[model samples]
Target: MDLKNVDLNLLVVFNDLLNTGRVGQTAERLGMTQPAVSNCLARLRRLLGDDLFIRTQQGMVPTPYAEALAEPVSYALGAIHSALNQSVVFDPARSRQNFVIAMTDIGEIHFLPALMARLAAVAPGVSVSTVRNLSIDLPREMEAGNVHLAIGLLPDLQTGFFQRRLFGQHYVCLYRHGHPLDHPGGMTLEDFTAAEHVGVVAAGTGHGIVDDLLARMGVARRLRLQVPHFVAVGHILRNTDMVATVPQVLAQCIAGPFGLSWCAHPVSLPEVSIGLFWHSKFHRDAANQWLRAQIVAIRPDGVDGGRTEDGATAL
Candidate 1:
């Protein structure tokens, strides 16, 4: 347990073994002989008092202790690497780095296209990966460095994280342009409740917002279909008479091309705030700051402010 007595290089070997699963492959990756790698593993086992990894037909299986250590150890190593890699000046034009983000399909639809275009033009060498939003522990994921950024509507973010508002979104009723409801120019609560509705329920605060709004107004729609993503709602609206209440930006993107029309929600709904979240550990990272700035810059105007209870104006 004494950190000063342990060799840091052994952890690197341990990580390689865990990743490659085969001792020979681990040795090759580390440019060491198989015997040396085996010796290092033995030393690690003795030091940690655990087997760490058990060989399996499929691959190396981490012991419970190793599983517990994996995230923290990997995170520590990553932070060390980032600290060592820091430069006095960041040169975006030539740097090759990978950034991992966690966002819902809606966020991907609205934010990624322009963001990728900008990155392609300015920082062509940078790479991006996105993971679907799930009801998992986001704070742990961010703290462990599994995700560099989390962008979406957060109900109650943990205190240690850094949050920056990227945009605001309001709900709008979307239907096919020539659908039966289009003639009225706008929908009333009666019409909305009568029409077939498509609903999207994603992780975080999305579903509750719609439900709360409906409860407040003493109105509820006949939900004919339920899907997990807003992107699917667009497709369903294109081919059917069912209308969906979706974020304004998403509706705007699909309305014209899909022969869709949008009207203000019949009952007032609270505006949803979309923000970019990251751990405080990365708050001062130059590349992270640049990426956040790019996201904020490309967000649609008038959607960056806080909303009120009645959804009248930004606070």
Candidate 2:
């Protein structure tokens, strides 16, 4: 338990091994030799008094003890990184940082175009990449500095992280422009529930909330098609007869491009709150701060002084 006697560099190797699950891959990622990585693992196992990972046909699998240590180790490294780089200056135009953001396909359509354009004009040297929210261990990745920020209606991230509300949106039923349900007066409840629906069943996403709400109100959708994500919703709805209930921002972004249209949901559903999220470890990091500012500048009309029940507004 003596911090000065133990090599903290081994923890970096340990975290990489936890993520990659392969010694060779971890070595490559950390710019070390395979034997060096193996030595680090050995050192870590000795220091921790357990075999952290075991080799198997699948890959190097972490033991239960290692799984338990993942969060604390990641957080410790984050704090160490924050402390060491506190005085680093970030010049957006000169920096070649590639930021990884977590979001859904809905976010790509609604935000990326404007965001990329803004980056091109201001921080041309900087680039952005995205991973699907909730598809991976987002919290761990953020703590490990793998994911810089997450932009979406991510409830899981509301706690133990800092977030700034981007916007508030409601659900709208989307369909082809000339579909029968595309009426000016809006479709009645009976018609809405009876119509064949294109349901989105993305795991742990806010889209499922509306479905649960309908069920609570004793309304059932005739789900003719169920998709894992909203990436293909617009394309499918543009050519099909089925309608989908989605965030109003997503609908607006796709309606014109996909030859689609939307109307307010027939059933009352709570509003969706999108936010800009990052781990507290990177709250004051210059590069992270600049990235956040860029996102805010691109869409400043979002809730400036709003606070969510989860304390998710700029904390």
Candidate 3:
């Protein structure tokens, strides 16, 4: 456990392995030979007294001990990197940095076009990639630098992360413009519960924010259709007698184009708070800070700052 005896460089290899899960790729990323990377892994195993990674058919699968070490090691390495490059200048126009973000389909629809346009005008050399927010290991993914930021209604984040409120959302029921429920006062909690519903499962738990709220109120709608992506909800509603409760922002953007009409939820539900979340490790990184600022600039008004009794907002 002597700090002097440990080669801190192994942590870099370990961090890369966590992201890439392959020694050859990790070696290429770190500019080291494959043999040298293997050597480093051996030393790391001895130092930590655990088989950090095991080769498998899929890839180098990390052991439970390795999974536990990933966060702190990546955090420490990132802090060291930030400290060393504290004076480094970031010019988005000239930098070819690729940023990966985690967000839901609805967030992408509402945010990406504006964000991409802004970046294209100013930071032509920079590119952004998005992955689904259904990743259960989002905090760990951010800590490993795989996900630069997660933008959505993320209520699962615990400590070791930072969040900034972007906007508040409320539920709105959407249906075809000519559906029976489109009439005034025709849509109620009773009508909604009895109607055929389209369920958009956004999280890994196979439930969306709307479903969670209904469950809290001891209500369950008849789910005639279940889809994992939000984009499909519009199509399903336009073609069926089903209804869906979605974020108001999403309804505004998609309702008109999809030949649908929307109204406020008949039942009271907690407001949805959308935010930008990132691990504390990247809080001081110049590129990450710039990206966060860009996201904040694109944020709409009426951001609800309400927090749950536990101080965490539920998605």
Candidate closest to the true structure, highest lDDT: 2
Q: Candidate 1 local accuracy as lDDT?
A: 0.77
Flag regions of model 2 displaced more than 4 Å: 134-137, 158-160, 305-315
lDDT of 2 by residue, 26-90 (tens): 88888899999999999889888999999999899999999998768867877888899889999
In angstroms, give how far residue 40 of model 2 lies from its true place: 2.3
TM-scores, each model vs. reference: 0.70, 0.86, 0.84
lDDT of 3 by residue, 1-315 (tens): 888988888888888898888889888878999999999999999988999999998789999999998777876887787788767778998999999999888888989998999999999999999987565467667776778988887667756777877887788899999998899875788888888998887765223656776798888889888887888888889998899988888898899899999998988877887778887777777888889878877876733345421343322
How much lDDT does each candidate structure score?
0.77, 0.84, 0.82
Clashing pairs in 1: 168-303
Against the true structure, candidate 3 reaches a TM-score of: 0.84
lDDT of 1 by residue, 93-206 (tens): 988988888888877887889889999999999988898656555665665456788888875555556677777778899998789999765898889989999878764745
lDDT of 2 at 147: 96
Ranking by lDDT: 2, 3, 1
Please give me the total number of clashing residue pairs in predicted model 1: 1
Per TM-score, the best of the predicted structures is 2
Q: What lDDT, from 0 to 1, does candidate 3 have?
A: 0.82
